[model samples]
Target: MKLAPLHAAKAAIESMSGDQVLHTVDGHAFIPMDDVWVVATPSGPASFNFNNLPGASPELRQQIKDVCRALLVSAAPSRASQALTAYRVLIRFLAEEMPGRAVEMISLRDVLRYGASLKAKELYKLRRLKEHLLLWVDLGIGGLDDDLLIRLPDLETKHHEVGAAVRTLDPETGPLTDMEYENLLSAIRNAFTEGKLTTSNYTLLMLAITLGARPLQLAMLKCGDFTVSARQDNSKIFILQVTRIKQGKGIRPRTIFRPRELAPALGTLIQQQCDEAREWAVAHDVAPEVAPIFLSDRSSINMGDIGLRGHHSGKSMAEKLRRLLKDLAVTSHRTGRKLHLFQSRIRRTLGTRAAAEGHSASVIADLLDHSWIDSSLIYVETRPAMMERIDKALALQLAPVAQAFAGTLVMRQDTDRGRIIHTATRSQLESVGTCGKHDYCRLAAPLACYTCTFFNPWLDAPHESLLDSLLQEREILANTADLRIAAVNDLTILAVADLVRKCGEMVGRATK
Candidate 1:
């Protein structure tokens, strides 16, 4: 019999069941015969091949491959991919450090040596490598034993401490400063005004800033996810239902309340997306209901097209943000800074701002979708202005307690200032050291006294010279181009000016 066409044969084979067997001679048409048994060459099953590690023995490489195959079978696709990459990195590192040695024979000392070769920032990778190795041992894919666990360094501790320190000092990775944030918002508004930013990009960026949602969550949002309703008070409320991709146990969706100010832009953007999505569905011959709200520009017009995936990937969304930021010239306000325009940083900026606004850690954790409260603590710790406010509140709270021990705290009538009362303690006056004039101390006498914490001013005090001196000193500092000195002088000037203003008010009242 003549052979069937290649496409036809493939179709027939695909339609056949695993139990049913068909034989073909000379790779032609399949013929069925029940009387005699005939064997046919089976096409090999598709398999993944790990790259050969340099300087690794054949046996060790085979063992690594076996473990990775086990991972591919047992783990989820994303996890399996990560495991494969992590294993390859570990094997490559091991191949260089301990050439020709079996993984089972890898000692704690060898692991430590491998860790030492990696930079501090790569500790998380090392930790992942350890996790994979442990998984391989548990699954019995490799000769590694439980003993290998003993040798692995405490990556969790090292990573935590180092990460905290880095987050505290590393300006690039942390949240945007107030000035930088304002600049970014201004740039975004300018971009919208100029029609340079796409509706999808603008909506996503706004959502990121306001809701602090991850890029993936934003990308995966469907048309049905957005909802607008009228409140009982006749005001419109815009609510976005975000699907938690990295959820555990139950599918708990998050609700993001769009601010009233952003509602108009959000509503307009969403309407545009719905129109685009419907058009895309019609173009691609797909159901309009199934189309994503945040469709990618690269999406194809047909379902069979290789580029038919409509939604943007998390990575592509981040890339779009980076390009937009670059175009806007959104550089950091801090020195030696670059435009850090990733989703996580934007989210972090929101979280940090919330923390600064006196939101509790638990509330922030809930907002950020953190599984633990500790994750939110980093934002709280990094906000110094918030800490200063907290410190001031605490000092006020402790004031009465301190006053109880310091005898009767009262305002004393001053000889120089007539009938003025000041909040002061005898202890404060006795313990606090006297001020000395340095090159820094430009303010003279009564004006300088207002800047001192120990020098409590009375409203009745003679402040004519103090006010004039403070104004003169401020003028002198303002005239100079030394910003640092001027800043310090400005603070002192404001404090003294406030005291002088209060004295004048008291004098007016006394006359009245």
Candidate 2:
């Protein structure tokens, strides 16, 4: 039997009855021809021919085809796609570089030499080739020799090392900065306000920034996915329910809230989408129901002469976003690199902000719908703003204790309530009477004591002068102190001034 040319094999597969072909696990039909396999696609049958492989024998080629068939049947769609590409890459290498050499006879050294010949960008394909070969051996489809498996060089470690080095050396690529984010928001708002942006583009950009949903998630959203609730106060709450697409199996949907201020805009966009969907349905003589929110203007699928409209794909959404960014002239400040606003980056930015705002790891994971909390760590790691916020929070919490230790305030235990402490400095303790509710007061000492009716100021406590000093100090600190710590200083100043006022009253009463 003679092997047919690649085109002839493809044509033969195309002519075969679909019922006669074997179906992959994904339910796609495929037909085997000589030493090649052809899988049916929407466009037509795609051929995977190994007859021209440099070192592969007829038997080895059949084994490769068997593995391809197994993958198509068992692997997920993304993995199946990768396997197909890997098969083609391996065949190309064998046919062009190692002509006439049997694949099974090729040593580990030969594989290494082949890898060395590939450029950096093509290095990932070599990894995929090794992965497919290993899978084939594991599945016992190829009956590959043990020596071939043992000699297969471990390229993963080297690949990772090189990748890390490249990332470190070229660290210019990163998330948007504060100013850049503000500028982007401004540009988007201005464009939307000016009617320059379409309803679809405006809604997509706003949702990307506010909800941080994945492109596929946004594309998959339907008009019914959003629920708006009205409160008694007349304010409305918008909730968007997103279906997770990337997770392989059995993942629950996630719900996110839209900012209250965006409610009006979101409502308008939803109304517009529904109106368009209804118009399309009416034009096509189809009953209108809840349909895709982001409908594609161009139909990719044929429905006779009627032409069926479907939801926009992730690729299409990304392209639309890119065009918007290009029109806005958004660019990175650090490297002056042209900015490509990706959905993933928007998600990262939101995750980082959530972490900075003191949300827990579990909360971040839940918000992002990550399977593991560790995955959320990537967004929060080494962010200086988050660290600073944490530090400031810690400092504020400890401010009272620090003041007490420095002799600026005092703490006295209330035996009646073991946890309650009466706060007053040595001077205040001598001048003012002890607070009656000190046993119940949970507030920081001195300040709360000053405003209490139990407070009695000493006649010679120099109350007027103390009030002047406190007012001056408060004004100075208010002007110079960091905003984060200024509130703590303000509280102390208010407490001391109240104590001084009470003392002045007592002094005046003594003189009378």
lDDT of 2 by residue, 1-512 (tens): 01122233334434665446655433455554445665532222345665644556667666666555555555433444455566556655655675655565444555566678787767765676786566655555443555766765444513322222112322233455443454466567556645788877887788778767776566656656666787899877665667664453212122332222346767767667767877776786655654667777753333111112355655566666667766865544334454556666666666765765567778877777666787676555534231112122242343332221111122233222222223333365333234443355454444444433333334344434444544555455556864333343333343344444444455577789
- Candidate 1: 10-residue stretch with minimal lDDT: 37-46
Clashing pairs in 2: 25-73, 54-94, 54-100, 55-101, 55-102, 55-103, 423-445, 423-446
State every prediction's TM-score relative to the real structure. Answer: 0.57, 0.57
Q: lDDT of all predictions, in order shown?
A: 0.51, 0.52
Candidate 2: global Cα-lDDT?
Answer: 0.52
- Candidate 1: which stretches are off by over 4 Å? 1-49, 56-63, 98-112, 116-124, 149-157, 160-171, 233-235, 246-264, 299-308, 336-338, 386-512
* Candidate 2 C-alpha error for residue 474, in Å: 18
TM-score of 2: 0.57
Candidate 1 lDDT over residue span 163-226, tens digit each: 3532563467767755456557656754664578876778767767777877656665666666
Which residue runs of candidate 2 sit more than 4 Å off their true CA positions?
1-62, 91-97, 102-131, 134-139, 147-172, 229-235, 248-264, 282-290, 301-309, 331-338, 384-512
